[model samples]
Target: MTTSNQKPFSYIAPGAPKVVKAGGVANLDLPILNLATNESSFGASPLVEQAIKERASQPNRYPDPASTDLRNAIGETFGLDPDLITCGNGSEEVIDGIARVYARPGDEILFSEYGFLQFPILCWRTGATPVKAAGDGLKTDVDNLLAAVTEKTKLVLVANPDNPTGTYIPAAEMKRLRDNLPSHVVLVVDSAYCEYVDDPAFTDGLELVAGHDNVIVTRTFSKAWGLAGLRVGWGYGPAEMISALNLMRGIGNVNAMAQAGAVAALKDPAHVDMVRAKTDEARNKFEADLKQFGVVAVPGAANFVLVKFPTEDTNRRAIDAHRHLAAENIYVRSNEDYGLDDYLRITVGTIEECDRVIESLQRFFAA
Candidate 1:
């Protein structure tokens, strides 16, 4: 075993999932229809386009170090105080900030078995121990996670509507977990895909942050707002937690154009509505198709489907399917490193994109 402080980072595992690497579509020298990244195929709002274009000329000016205006917009949208909000270049940055602020050497961070892959990576960067609680059929099992907590556990991350799998813990269950967790552990709910979710029973996380000092809910423009390129995400929590994350991040984290784009994206409710409707339709079609293939598709509130492979050659099948789809200008994700080597995560795309992927799978299975 390598030491944690070994050069070139012995802590972060080399050969992490291939799917996490960039260019599922871009690298495949084919026609390139990418459904791999869980990106909004509907693209950004026109308002954001106009705002970016308007701000393009002012590249020389330094962005707001405080992110004052963007913070205000986020607070207003979520009905939180500005002091309770913290913005960063991306939510990943916020994750790092949390580790820096709360974790010290030898401290442990707890997460579900299949939570966002990045949270553990952040813990490692801070020289903290990353621990996992067993997940309940890909859904975050709050009971198991709560049991995993100890005095050494300083952070607990729950990715509601968890990525790749898309399963969500209901609001009631989350409340029970939060109410039961140790006070010393800070709870982070990464709501990256929250905007696409339709269930009223789902916890928004921000509402809990309203009164709870230990709970922090983070959101992003990357998922639903189609601002993945710009990378603007924020967290809402008690004033003290937000301030601590801010102090850890220091100044000039978010740039000027990203702030402008996010502010504009907030104003365009119609775009969000349109994408949600389309995504729901696509999800229904894809789920039905997966059933015919004898694949067990997990029910999720998010915008992607996690389908388990039937054969022992799960990794090969997924890679072949991905490669074949790229030949036909379509792309999807194969989960080898999330510890589910037998499952492939397919993002919901346009009706045409969905059909292309389904067709490619049909051909792959036929052979």
Candidate 2:
């Protein structure tokens, strides 16, 4: 049916459109309690708002293509060399850049079975094979990952305090993974939820990047700093890897307002600490409350909790709960696509929001 001059095109398997279940729906008749996306419920730092307002005056000019000031501020905050840092529109952009720069058409990119969904999509877009290593009880298992690696493997991505499951491996295990991977294989450690983790055993992969040339650690302002709206993220790695990413990244990828907001957000450590404390308190309370309802709350180190519901006949399955909550204008993420059919991923919201969802769940089960 195609014209002689026109070429036919189609995406590969598993390259279908993804249905993202994000929070913060607008124009609802009732007050909506959104515990779907793992965003900071406390909002961004006051300084960020001020910075954005001030930067809004210069809308006529393009942002700094190199993001010099933002990179310097990030370096100062994390004790990293500015040359080793690369700022992006978001951590997802940096991840995409990694796949584009390192993976070839036939190369393999490996991740956990339930790792961040973006990893596979990024690989598929680049014509790279996405390999999934079996997870050990919803947690990244270094042994499984090592076993899955082959000569074709070009990159490995691990999301620490991983989304949906919110589970993570310890520092020792991460080091083992890095040491075992081939020198040509780039290990990308995504620490999007690192700010919320307080476990002593957990490492954000920064130290690993310091000692290894093939390792890169990506972080985001979306989680703790509450700059998800601005879409600012940064990555730290070896100078060579940073240079490669910079070469392939779009010019002026981060806008002026986002850069200004991120710089201010980085300066305010007290604000980040406050957000972390509130998230920890709310998450702990939510898990304990879920336990009271006989729901299996998966132990997590991130800003969200995964609650496994009973079977469908009990009217407490994840799909039923999601529908019931939606009718009440309370939205939570269902994990059916992540292969966790009976579990719901609920963001750690404010105390009031948490109480509302918990009470709603109680009413759903009671009825």
lDDT tens readout by residue for model 1, 1-367: 0011111221124642332222354333335565667777778898998998888899999889888989888878767788888998888788778878898889999999998888778777888999999999789999999999999999999988898789999889888888999889899889888887888888677778766789988888887788877989888888898878888885888988999999999898788898889888988988788776676788886667888767765543666565565455555676776888677787787777777777867876776
- Per candidate, the number of residue pairs that clash is 1, 0
Cα displacement (Å) at residue 131, model 1: 1.1
Model 1 C-alpha RMSD vs. true structure (Å) is 6.8
- What's model 2's overall lDDT? 0.85
Question: Who wins the lDDT comparison?
Answer: 2
Task: Report RMSD (Å) for each prediction in the order shown.
Answer: 6.8, 7.9
TM value for model 2: 0.91
Per-residue accuracy of model 2 over 31-131 as CA lDDT, tens digit each: 75657777778888789989999999989999999999999999999899998999999999999999999998999999999998898898778999999
- Judged by whole-model lDDT over C-alpha atoms, candidate 1 comes out at 0.79
Q: List the candidate 1 regions with Cα displacement exceeding 4 Å.
A: 1-29, 312-316, 326-329
